[model samples]
Target: MTTLIAEDLLLLLLDDVKGTPTSSYLDVALGGALLLELALAEAVHVRERTSVWSSAKVDVAPGAVVSDPVLADALGRVAERERAASDLVTRLGKGTRDALTARLAERGVLRREDDRVLGLFPRTRWPEADGRHEDEIRARLTAVLVQGLDPDPRTGALVALLHAVGAAPSAVDRGGVPARDVRRRAKEVAEGTWAAKAVRDAITASTAAMSAVMAATTAAAAAGS
Candidate 1:
């Protein structure tokens, strides 16, 4: 099966042993990945920032093929008007991780088990169903992050996305990769100008979006308490 950049990212975020997310921001990260795919497809566009790396807004651009509901829904979020990157992240990524997980389950890349934690609250767990595909993803990422090499456009975008979501350590050093080198290279991919102008803008937009969502979530939690 042809793997998507988002799929690769989702695999990295998943635990090989427990088949659970390694980060709390999996939805945001996955959402950001979907937008990146849209940006690459020209289905979405990020307006140039007024300030350096600030106020990067994403808007639906039309003309790009809407392949699936995931991408379609992502486009819908940006359809009305350009919104702050952060707002877009929260809007587009909301509950999207589960959607991606379901798709993966249908594809046989993962196994889904539905149950209740204490015979009360229903819960779902997707365990590692197959390791071959995820292993390929890991190898590709490892070559770029551990070997100090230039990443292809897609891989570069993945790195930036992971960085934006603060999951680089989880991706690179989880399997004994040198944390320092992995972090340094991952940072470059995230902050580097090596990618196309559109991709770079998309990364910036996603970073802003994740930051905005995290801040909002934090504030809301604090207020509730």
Candidate 2:
């Protein structure tokens, strides 16, 4: 009998990517989520049917398969979320796409886009080539998290805000540091560590800048109206 771990399932989903900058982060996340859910369901099914499997440990009977309704339902839910995320990525603009491609390019994946078609392209070609840029962006973001970059509250905060507003995962990861520890070190940076202080200050400044931009946009619209 084969045993599977959570990390094993994660790898299976990540493996589906073609190693191109254009892979879909949404798909990756969704797939990973589904795989984890399914693994859980399988574990439960096995536990519940322990007696039957044990009685026929060595018996390979035809049509002796047991259906797991729980896993099936979970899979369906994941599929719906995946579809929604996919739709979101498909609607990104050229600027977002370029930003994503640039991030992948930093990691040695160069994507090129033709003005005649989608107007941009990443170096590596994958399924739904135009959409792969977002995937690459997502990959880069996850890489930052894995590397412990502490992108939040400043860089990570901005990235998170962008993510909230529909920025692709790749762009956020590439452009922002990881946000895990930004808050924890805020006071330390303000009182002592120059590096930490600098990061905190930068985040504050960027946030202010974004807020100003939004305010101006809103004011302009109000005045025009």
Candidate 3:
């Protein structure tokens, strides 16, 4: 089965043994990935920012449709109305990780385990079941980030999302490369012309939005604590 870019990202976010997310912001990253997928299908577009202070907004194309149920649902939500990319990131991303995880589990790429934490809370975990596919994704990331190869659009978008979520550095083996250099390279690729100009704009907007929300949430949690 062909997996979505979002699926590839989830695989990276998940711990192979722990079956839990390494980052707390999985939804934001997955949401950005979904937006990228919609952009690739021409199902959605990001309105240009009128000013530097303005946020990019995402809107659905007229009559846009996708075959995948997950993408289709997200497209329908986008079709409801134009929204700031940041707002859409959280809105579209709500509960999406679970849906994607279930899909991955169905495909046998992950194994679902249900457990109770101290017999008080219910939880689910998705550990690696068939790692071959994930291995391929890691190889692609290594090629682009470490081997200095240019990325195809899909791989490039995946890198951009991983970088956006601050997970790029840990997603693959650095092969003795310095962490800072790896980060710099990932940033360069995220800003590269691997994708169309419009798509690039969407990616930039989506990632910026995700970052803004993540930061705000972090601050809010800190304040609450």
Candidate 4:
């Protein structure tokens, strides 16, 4: 699943760079890398259960009740958080692509120029044409890139909580720190207190709204079929 998601993301990045000069390949590559991280996070969330295992087999863990509502609610919250992260990933991908195009245009690199000498010049030469302009473009791109690439504090915290409930293994390794401990720390970093609850509520509401839309679309398609 990860491999498929990575390939799909690479293709999307390539499409975004299509028609741009080869000289700008490095820029496109860097942008694509950042985009890929965001995409992976989203993909992980969207396909969390299916991607990890064929079936969610819960071990009774010696005298644990399987029909606990609290446990069920916790599981539901995790799913909702994943859905929200997936939605954010889609939004961020579009925003990043659009921002890249706009920045390139502002830098005058979007248009084809007829000057043979300038055409032969390196990519750095064009940026030297207007240092201040290039700086501004870089600044704007950096700001957007940082925001979208990093995990949202709220969601990250929620993921940490889910890890606790599920006893999930940590994706990152820290020596001497147990996986659960690391996840709990991450949750602390992502959520201070009240904000996490608010974010949880928002995710729950958004999931319901999005599910309704998807169901309606599926039903309409089925009717037509």
Candidate 5:
């Protein structure tokens, strides 16, 4: 079974049968997942002892051979210099969703079909090919959010990602996990050590930054309207 965080995040973003993402939020969320994966793998990180989170230096762990082309590319860019978590999130998020979708399709979890936008511009659609694996993933999240069970590091990270992207409600709806419980338990997971302290700190800072950007955008749109 492909147990990469990216794979799991992709599964959650996509429908079990349709294989389509629940929303555009999946894009940035998956980018956060990628950075978390690097943190978990000790491949990249933000510096410690920085008074400000935004100005903290982001660096790749020395000598890590990231196998995924997408990851490798990200590492190369992130390694170039230090940047704020929000800045890195914006930079790292580019291309992550499509890369993960391709990876999932390669694993047979989904299949890509040629299509067109409005029956005009060329497009591609990913439909679910297999669901058992994703079902297992959902079951674990169910256990955590509904059963009040302690999640393993991987599951914990997934819980954090789902909540980070505002998908927690839908993710737990099938099992009827309460929104309150989802928020409470998801906090525990996010606070838990799914990775090194440095990595965990990075995830927290990055997600917060992303949320702020979303809020500001919404406020700006409201004002404009």
Candidate 6:
């Protein structure tokens, strides 16, 4: 089965050697990726806000059949009621990492490693089992973000998600390109006039929501520390 964009994003954020995620805001990014995938699949529609004060509204596309269980579950949740795209990011993304990671492990793209931190706290890690697929994904990202090539919808959507999570600069090797230049390029692609207005609005809402979630998480962690 073809991997979802969310899966790809998770793979990118995960450290291949340590089998741990590089980003703290992974769930938010994963949720945003699912929304974007649903948008691309036409399984859901994100209506543009009618006014500046209104949020982008999300609605399930009637009779949309999502073959993947992960997406199907998200589509079902979306069908429950219309919601602001921003609100659904967290709602739909909740508890998705386990499912996605398990799927990747099942597919042999990753290996499940059960261990303990300091031999005291139990923890699980997913180290790279097969890297060919991730290498291909990185190649595509490099082509667009650093090589200045036009991106297809999937690639464009991936870039937008990476940008949302503030990972675009680190997602790929910059080679000769400056990190700022890569970031600027990602921002341009993310905000460019390539996708439909609805898709664009969804991305914008997801980005805002992702940022908010990340901020809250960071603050909470600091407070706890």
Give the TM-score comparing model 3 with the true structure, all chains together: 0.97
Q: Please give the lDDT score for candidate 1.
A: 0.79
For residues 92-117, write the lDDT of model 5, one tens digit per residue: 77887777778878888888888777
Q: Scored by Cα lDDT, where does model 6 land? A: 0.89
Clash pairs, candidate 1, are 86-209
Against the unseen true structure, what C-alpha lDDT does each candidate score? 0.79, 0.32, 0.90, 0.32, 0.74, 0.89
Arrange candidates by lDDT, descending.
3, 6, 1, 5, 4, 2
Query: Which is better, 3 or 4, measured by lDDT?
Result: 3
Model 1: ten consecutive residues of lowest lDDT: 172-181
Q: State each candidate's clash count.
A: 1, 21, 0, 0, 0, 0
TM-score to true structure, per model = 0.89, 0.27, 0.97, 0.23, 0.86, 0.94
Question: Which candidate has the top score in TM-score?
Answer: 3
Give candidate 4 misplaced runs (Cα > 4 Å): 1-195
Q: Over all chains combined, what TM-score does candidate 6 have?
A: 0.94
Candidate 2, 1-225: lDDT as tens digits: 111221122222232334333323333322222232233333211111145223101111223222433334434443343222222222221133333334434444343333323556434332222334345444544544444344423224323333322332324333354343433232222223223333333223323333334456568889999
At residue 168, candidate 2 shows an lDDT of 27
For model 6, the superposed segments whose C-alpha errors exceed 4 Å read 222-225
lDDT per residue (tens digit) for residues 1-225 in model 4: 112211222222222224332222222222222322322233211222354323211111223222323223323334343233323322323334344444444555443223344568543212122234333423332232222233444234333222222221222324455655655554443334434343433333333333333456568889999
RMSD (CA, angstroms), candidate 3: 1.0
Please give, for residues 1-225, the per-residue lDDT of candidate 1 as tens digits: 776667788888888767788877878877788888888777788888888656887777757668777888878778867688777776777878788888998888899888887899988888888878877776777888887778888888888888776677667534666676677778887888777788788888787777778778779999999
Residue 211 alpha-carbon offset, candidate 2, angstroms: 1.8
Write out the backbone clash pairs for model 5.
none
Number of clashes found in candidate 5: 0
lDDT of 6 by residue, 154-203 (tens): 89999999987788988887997899999999999999878887777777
Q: Is candidate 4 or candidate 5 better by TM-score?
A: 5
The alpha-carbon deviation from the true structure for residue 130 of candidate 6, after best TM-score superposition, in angstroms, is: 0.5
Q: Candidate 4: deviation at residue 166, Å?
A: 20
